[model samples]
Target: MTSHPTVGHVHLRVADLDRAIAFYRDILGFDVTQQSATAAFLGAGGYHHHIGLNTWDSLNASPPPAGHTGLYHSAFLYPDRASLGTVLCRVAAAGITLDGAADHGVSEAVYLRDPDGNGVELYRDKPQAEWPRNPDGKLAMINARLDVQAIMDEAP
Candidate 1:
């Protein structure tokens, strides 16, 4: 069996396909690789698609109520801190408000909601050697504050 398979794509049901496209394409800098009247495929660095947005059944539908069982968030990993910071700048320029930012020992992440209210996490992982571990060598992930301003300052 193949070990350590990577997640290749995430397909989302959005309320307004155009609005979702604006957020993912215009704001987040993904390329619109394909699109239909009610669907879109977005990718970065060009490999088919990383995210698919469709409104087949969710057209004009409302977001799920709080305290419901569903996707908590879909995380998009960046290659480095500078890349993540560039995204932060784009997000700010788009006037989208962030839910929060955090340092999770091995990663720095910023959280926000999409136009359809789905949670999105933008993050960059630290080097494997920098990961925190307990005395027994188990990973010790911590939820700590991230200095977002400092991160933004590193944007290219």
Candidate 2:
């Protein structure tokens, strides 16, 4: 594997294809590249896909029970704080309640669940020079309350 390889995409099993599409497309603003009765591929900036939603084996299936080992969340990184805030506003307008919001020293993030109950995180990273570091130069990440209103103020 290449040392600099990046995560290409995330594929999720969803109970309803259309509902998932509405959330990812209408709410989060990803463009739908391709879709079928059982699956859909969505992307940003015209890449092939950053997210894949499917109902092949999971059609109408319920989300996994709590405490079971499974995916924690799939995070989407916005290009900047304004972009992140813009999407956060859309989520709020759509009546989606955020699970949490935090400043993690290097980034600000908002957490929520998709229509199928899959965890999702939307965030924007601060510049490398702004990341917190310990005296030894190691990262010193902290979870602190993020002023979501401040971010919204920066949105277009």
Candidate 3:
């Protein structure tokens, strides 16, 4: 059997190149390393790009209608719970509403929508040993409300 591929980068067709850059760069803290008239590349920690935004066909396009099968959500994993709390506070201060926040047994996640209505998940994974497992030794992920205050208390 062939090995599955790791995710390289996520490329999106955006309605406006500069606007998308601002959301990813100014808001999400991605660094813009490359740009053309139509394509832009963004990265964090200066290791090339983790995301690419292009306005090829979506130059003035609106978001896909609800119930579409594309892009359920893209998760951005934070380094720690404090970072997660910081992001949560930033999102709150920006007046962006969360779709949900959950403690998923293995991770704590906060869900929101990007400027283009794309779902985004910001999360931090719990240690492997702390994750719950079923009787069969498979992961037993449960979605319950996350204690936001407790997490923020961990923030420096």
Candidate 4:
């Protein structure tokens, strides 16, 4: 049995395929690897597909209501601080309002909702050597304010 398995991708049921594609491709900078009338596959850096969007069961459907048990969010990891900041700038330029931003000890993250009201998190992990640890050597993650301005300043 393998103890290390990485998350391969996320498949989402969206209301509009084209609109969702615009958000993930245009705003978030993923390339449209493949698409159909009701589905699209997007990826970064030429990977097959990191995100799969489909209108199969949710065409023109409303987003899930609040206080329900469903997908909380989908997190996308950036390679570095500057890359993360660059994406944040793109997000802002697209007029997308962030839900929040935080420094989670081991990573810095910004949360926002997608075009279909699906929660999305964009983040970058700090080096393992920089992750916080308790005196007893246990992980000590913290949710603190992220200096978004400082991060954005690092963008190319």
Question: Which candidate has the highest lDDT of all?
Answer: 2
TM-score of each prediction: 0.96, 0.96, 0.91, 0.96
- Count of backbone collisions in candidate 2: 0
Q: 27 in model 2: Cα distance from truth in Å?
A: 0.9
When summed lDDT is taken over every stretch of 10 residues in candidate 2, the lowest stretch is 1-10
Stronger candidate by lDDT (3 vs 4): 4
* Candidate 4 TM-score, true structure as reference: 0.96
**Local accuracy of candidate 2 as per-residue lDDT tens digits, 1-156:** 657878999999999999999999999989999999899999999999999999999999999999999999999999999999899889989999999999999999999999999999999999999999999999999999999888877889
Candidate 2 residue spans exceeding 4 A from truth = none
Candidate 3, 1-156: lDDT as tens digits:
889988878888899899888877876668999999999999888769988999898998999999978998888888899988877777777788889889999999988988888888889999999999999999999999898878867767
Model 4, 1-156: lDDT tens digits are 769879989999999999999999888889999999989999999899999999999999999999999999999999998998898899989989999999999999999999999999999999999999999999999999999988889999
Would you list the C-alpha lDDT of every candidate in the order shown? 0.94, 0.95, 0.87, 0.94
Residue pairs with clashing backbones, model 2: none
The local lDDT score (0 to 100) that residue 93 gets in candidate 1 is 85
Name the better of 1 and 3 by lDDT.
1
Every model: Cα RMSD to truth: 1.1, 1.4, 1.9, 1.2
Which ten-residue region of model 3 has the weakest summed lDDT?
86-95
